[model samples]
Target: MAFIFESDLKAFLFCLLQFVIAIVVSYSFSNYTNPEQRKLEKVAMLELKVEQTEKDIEQLRDLTRSLEGKYQNIESVHVPLVAFHVYNPLHTNLEVGQVIVYQTVPLNEGNGYDRKTGIFTTPVTGLYQFSAHICNQDNAMFVYAIVLEGETIALSTQRDMPSSCNTVNALTVASAGQQVSVQGVHMSKSYQVIENPHRKNSFNGVLLHRT
Candidate 1:
């Protein structure tokens, strides 16, 4: 009976050792990760980086376009407004071949006009529009002309008409400091430009377009 109990004890100790070894192997295997799952995680990280890089490139392109627009605006030319209008309220006429000095100035932008000299000096080099209104009385024939630097550019003729008015216009390209004026011209004898209570002579100029 003692010999039988000794053999049973040895078999029980061997079985317990085998069970502990199997549990340790299973726990180690459960902790191990698959190689395919690691590769998939790396690929997902690369995809996120590529998406962020694409967004950065798009933002850079937008900034380039904005800079290009501002550069174009900087290269463009800027034009200014220049204009003047003057007229004499005196009830008397001006002398023939004499510059009409309009004393009462309603508008004189740029301060380029001189009322004492009856000249409108150009403030800038640009295209200019000039106009004049001439009035006469007592059936006196008179011719008026818009002069630029001693050259006539426009004219209006009154042929023996009593209390008549005529309007003349001139479009010219003028340089800075050039003078513009209205004068009576092409008359056999000296005549007067009429300005009375019934009529008023006017001279005006404006910068139509800048070049």
Candidate 2:
């Protein structure tokens, strides 16, 4: 009976050793495979984050370019544009309803005034102020008008006097390529001379505001 009891105790010891070995192998395999799987999942998450960041950066660049283009367009359209002043130093004769061609320019800011043609062409759509001063050398009645786009806008009539002067001023809006000039008319049936040796006979224009 003792020998049988010893044999039963030895069989119990063998079974306990087998159970311990199986538990250790299972723990070791689980530890190695779990970390590798976690690393693969982390790498995939990082790749997705990087792709999303790249797309965000590209969208920002496109938005910046669009804003810059709009800013440039605004800058180009609203700048201050046209101004001119011209005078005639020599004495000149004029017939009735004739355009006075002022042949000298002292201040032509935008080069819109033509000294040869005696015309100011507007460079942009804006309100402008134009002024003309005329001095009659011959003691006779004369009338002068500020001509804008082939129509009179302002007129000044001087009575018969020695060295009489008349000034006409007009404030009007003009479009691009519109013309402005000064026209003179003699009340009598004779020509009139403008004596302006001191550069008194003058025409001036300036841009007031853009439309």
- List the global CA lDDT of all models: 0.81, 0.81
Candidate 2 lDDT score relative to the true structure = 0.81
TM-score to true structure, per model = 0.61, 0.76
Off by over 4 Å in 2: 1-24, 27-31, 51-77, 89-91, 185-191
Model 1: which ten-residue window has the lowest total lDDT? Answer: 88-97
- Clashing pairs counted in every model: 0, 0
Residue ranges of candidate 1 with Cα displaced over 4 Å:
1-76, 89-96, 188-191
Summarize candidate 2's per-residue lDDT along 1-211 as a digit string, tens digits: 9999999999999899999999999999999999999999999999999999999999999999999999988876675857777777233656666777877787888888887778889888888999998876566677888988879999988765666777788999999899998887555525455654552788899998777
Provide the lDDT at 82 for model 1: 80
lDDT of 2 at 143: 81
